[model samples]
Target: MILLQANNVMRRFGADVLFHDVNLQIQEHGRTALVGRNGAGKTTLLKMIAGITSPDEGTIAKSKDLTIGYLAQDQGLDSQNTIWAELDLVFAPLHKMEKQIHQLEDQLASLDPSTRKFQLTTEKYSQLQADFKKRGGYEYESRMRGILKGFGFEEDDYQTAINSLSGGQKTKLALAKILLQSPDLLILDEPTNHLDMNVLAWLEDYLKSYQGALLVVSHDRYFLDRVVSDIYDLDNHTLRHYTGNYTQFMEHKQEWLTAEWKHYEQQQKKISKLEDFVNRNIVRASTTKRAQARRKQLEKMERLERPETDDKSIHFRFYSEKDSGNEVLDVEKAVVGYNDQKLAGPLSFTVRKPQRIGIIGPNGIGKSTLLKSILDRIPLVSGTIKLGANLQIGYYDQEQQQLHPEKSVLNEVWDDHPNIAEKDIRSLLGSFLFVGDDVYKLVHDLSGGEKARLELTKLSFKPINFLILDEPTNHLDIDSREVLENAINEFNGTVLFISHDRYFINQVATDVLDMNALGIKHYEGNYDNYLEAVNKEKATNANQDESQTTTTKPKKSSAQQSYQQSKETQRARRKLQRRVDKLEEEMTVLEEKQEAIKEQMSQPEIATDIGKLSDLQKKLDKFTTQSEDVELEWTSAAEELEKFDQENS
Candidate 1:
């Protein structure tokens, strides 16, 4: 049940081969991940597998009737239809069937019951009903609603046009549509880019139940660990498969590289010994035959090439001009936003010396704005922000706002440090992996990864005691991110940064500032520790919930409580309706008995039988009493149901 396979696949850029003779296969319900460095052509390989691009050298085989759904990196949904309408399109076939069923119903009602056309229409309606039910027509809307909610879209947002959403929201909408489609093979590239923790967790749960093959390309290690089981490492113009999650892959990869390099080194030493013997003895008169034999053997020996490795990663550290005071920053009742509209914060926080704080929140909750407000790049809506003595802040904008796009890569850094010698500046740029021709390239022409590297280069040279970064790891590759993390961890400076990379936060953050509409709250620990605390608190609250289920007290999570309440209301209404139906059934039996009793009483033979008439009269009285009681019970149940519905609604 292999859905797709790329055999002897080759992809190239100009004359440079990205990967050659790469073979990959995905089963009908397999999960695989394609991982490599940023410039290792992972995306190109994905496009080829997705059928959006053709392989340069080999053919891609697929099972007949294979449906592939590809969600590109940051692919946005731009449509005139509302969010609900866009999602509903996933069930287009079912929707068409629904319309056809209605038409058949109309035809059945209008046609004569005895006609052949009526029978044919009835058969067609039954067939359509079966197909529609198989396609989940009855529950598609509810599925759409649930998936949308999981992606952070509320019921009210369903009516909003797709084009009206932000880029991140649109990307999420696209992901939701693909998940609903449930194609045989799902190829997703960086699907976790814009999702918050809530959405990310929901997606993990959803994908666990997805009945399709998944081939994903992402740098989110935690996401990879949770979602994928196998890893395809694309390195040095080839692909190697590894078993297990991201953490396991790292361990296995290191073991493989070690073994490979060891074999190569052993062969190299043997070849060196043979060459030395041939060189020393071939010129001598003695042992000429032996030298000839050695020469022949050396010529015949198969040489092992050195193991390939990507080692030219950026290496630099934050250089502090001087240590700042004990208190680096102070904010009292600070509101951060644009104009008069507040995104978050009528809040307070302190950044002490050398404390690395990571800011986290949902998209558009003003995490970046908070950084700018503290730096005084944008005006605060209210209150005060104070910087302590001997503070020189270095800011890294995720968008690369600090760099001049018109300037060369070298000049972007050199222009800021005009006093530095040209040779020294070149040395600094070289350390950041901008060497020779790379330095001459304009900042605008640099790729996202390059821009990030260049930014880090500039930041490393800055003598600052306070670093404020907004999404600093946005464009960095896994290797560079790790290097940056090391630098940040080692830096003796105060740090405040906004990031959605949980791995990065976990690696570098000493404390986390959870931002929301209400304000920012401080948690003392790394991201993982904070999550543990939150989960522990949830479990505690859940235990309390059991005891307080009958109370009117408010719950910690309003959303969870509301969902539980709605489920309970639905259950109660269903139970009440069932009781009403039972009463109706009982009443029907009693009425039928009464009709039989009356008919017997009306019979000419029975009219003369006084004893039979008395029996019939008693039976009629019993039936009447039973029917009246049933009617009362039915009325009471129905009334209670109505009242309950009103209260809940």
Candidate 2:
């Protein structure tokens, strides 16, 4: 059954139409996601569907008695009641029923057994009890507790007054309350905001099993991929539905665009040919009839509109004037904190040239603090940080404090490089989507996304070989994030950045740094890779625990067995180390071969020689493939060896 439907929904802002002739529907237990570029009217559409606003040109209809629980982006609860009390409001009807049931029970105890009043009271009491059970009266508190805990509210926090909670906490409480209500349709806009990785995982699981249909609007591609099964892309003043997760949607969208462009171009060619034939023959007397027929056919034909292109994105590449040394940065036993208070530390890590390292951790675990310490913006409590020779560092602050808010957007970039011409400065700003009159806007007036783009424009303008970024994707839309990812991948530099955007990390990270308050754990791949390794570690630990519990050996035998296991582990480590060394040697040789072939291909004589160039290109390709294989093997072996050594130590 269709729970809700929007037909020909049209919204307008002032004189301009945001979108029109929009249509969407949600069936019972449907999971739909609304996605679009920033300012493409996604939130507005959601608000219209949630009945917070009215559409200008269409109707939104829902099933009779349909209930909707809408959680807007960053929508917080404003209540004087305690956290538990606020959530307990969801059970008000049940509470009232329970009260009446108790009153009925009290009356039954005093009334005569054969009296009509007693019989009527007994019947009412039985019906109330049945209704209470059907409505989950007994499990409501436990359900509330489960939801509150899932949103990170503990029993201790239950009594805390809602007015005292932080904005993020209040938002969480609002979500918890709405979830407990369990409306027939749950509408969430950016619900993943302010949620930690663990909480995000929990929410994903919870929503997967949710009883109601879900309609969410979020830029979190990873979360959407996990939670939503369908995607509704609002673009170019229209909505297009795709039947898959975000990843699959991207694939299907590309294919669809390709096909649409092809069809459009083909129709254009046919129209052009017909028009040309008519123009040439229309003046000739003998062929005037044919020309008229062709003209009639042309008049009867329908022309296809040009396919919309996604060219409205900021486009730029990251370039380095010079290369940094092989060792870009090295931090040993580093403790990062502020004012004698430790946040996260006793950490050690090394960044090599051309490596993009993504640092991830729960909120407030000091991932950003680590970057500041490395930049010497804050003093480290202990340990040392060293930068290798010829290294030029570029930092992108999450707070964007580096940007002078008082300066205009054009002046912001121009002030940094005064030698550049005004035209060039404007051109650079234009590439970042700060066009015509936009460049004159003060930095303070720009939106968060605009400031982010402007900051990136400045970063791109510099000639640096090392990038240290903190939450770089904080305010970027999905398209802008993809552009930034491409720029980072094309950069010939080392990058150490902190990000909570898993899709961005997966796209750009060469390694993952999992940080915690206690310490840091290094993983060899992206977010999914980190999760895989973590699961394997958990399984191994569980197995060890089970073995310990079931062990029957004496203490001495166990000690000897441990010693033998240690020896075997050492042997395995040695073998892995040897494999790693050999692969590294192979990779070095393959890289040299590739460079030599490229140099040969670059020669003026060889460049002009097609066969010679082709042969060298094939050789280069073969060596590159081999190099990638060897690197993968080396990574696997090195990770295994690192684990073994850490275990033994």
Top candidate on TM-score is 2
The reply for model 2, stretches above 4 Å from the true place, is 544-649
lDDT (0-100) at residue 438 of candidate 1?
91
Instruction: Please give the distance, in angstroms, between residue 432's alpha carbon in candidate 2 and its true position after superposition.
Output: 1.1
Candidate 1 local lDDT, 1-649, one digit each (tens): 8888889999888998888989988987788999988888899999888888899999899999899999999998989999998888889898889999999999999999999999988998999999899889899998998999999989989899988789999999999999999899999999998898779888877886789989998888777866787999998888899987776788799999999999999988888898888888888898778989988988888777789866678899998867789989999998888997988878789999878999988888888888888888899988899999999899999988888989999789888999999899999889888888999999899998899889889888889889998888887878888899888876778899998888788777879998898888889877766776676666677776655544434333553344344434544665576577678778898899999999999999999999999999998998899899889988998898788778866
| Cα displacement (Å) at residue 250, model 2 | 1.1
lDDT of 2 by residue, 1-649 (tens): 9999899999888999889889998989998999999989999999999899999998999999999999998999999999988889999999999999999999999999999999999999999999999999999999998988888878999899999988988998888889999999999999988887888889998998999999999888889877888989998988988997787788789999999999999999999999999999999999999999989999999888999944589999887888899998888989889997999888998999878899989888888888988889899988899989998889999889999989999999998899999999999888988889999999999998899999899999998899998988877888999899878876768999998888788777879999988788889866766876787677666666656545533344443355345435544664576577678878888989998999999999999999999998888889988889889888988888888788877
Whole-model lDDT per candidate: 0.86, 0.87
Which ten-residue region of model 2 has the weakest summed lDDT? 551-560
Look at candidate 1 and tell me the lDDT of residue 468.
Answer: 92
Q: Report the Cα lDDT for candidate 1.
A: 0.86
TM-score, prediction 2: 0.83
What are the runs in model 1 whose C-alpha is more than 4 Å off?
A: 110-121, 280-300, 543-649
Candidate 1 TM-score over all chains jointly: 0.81
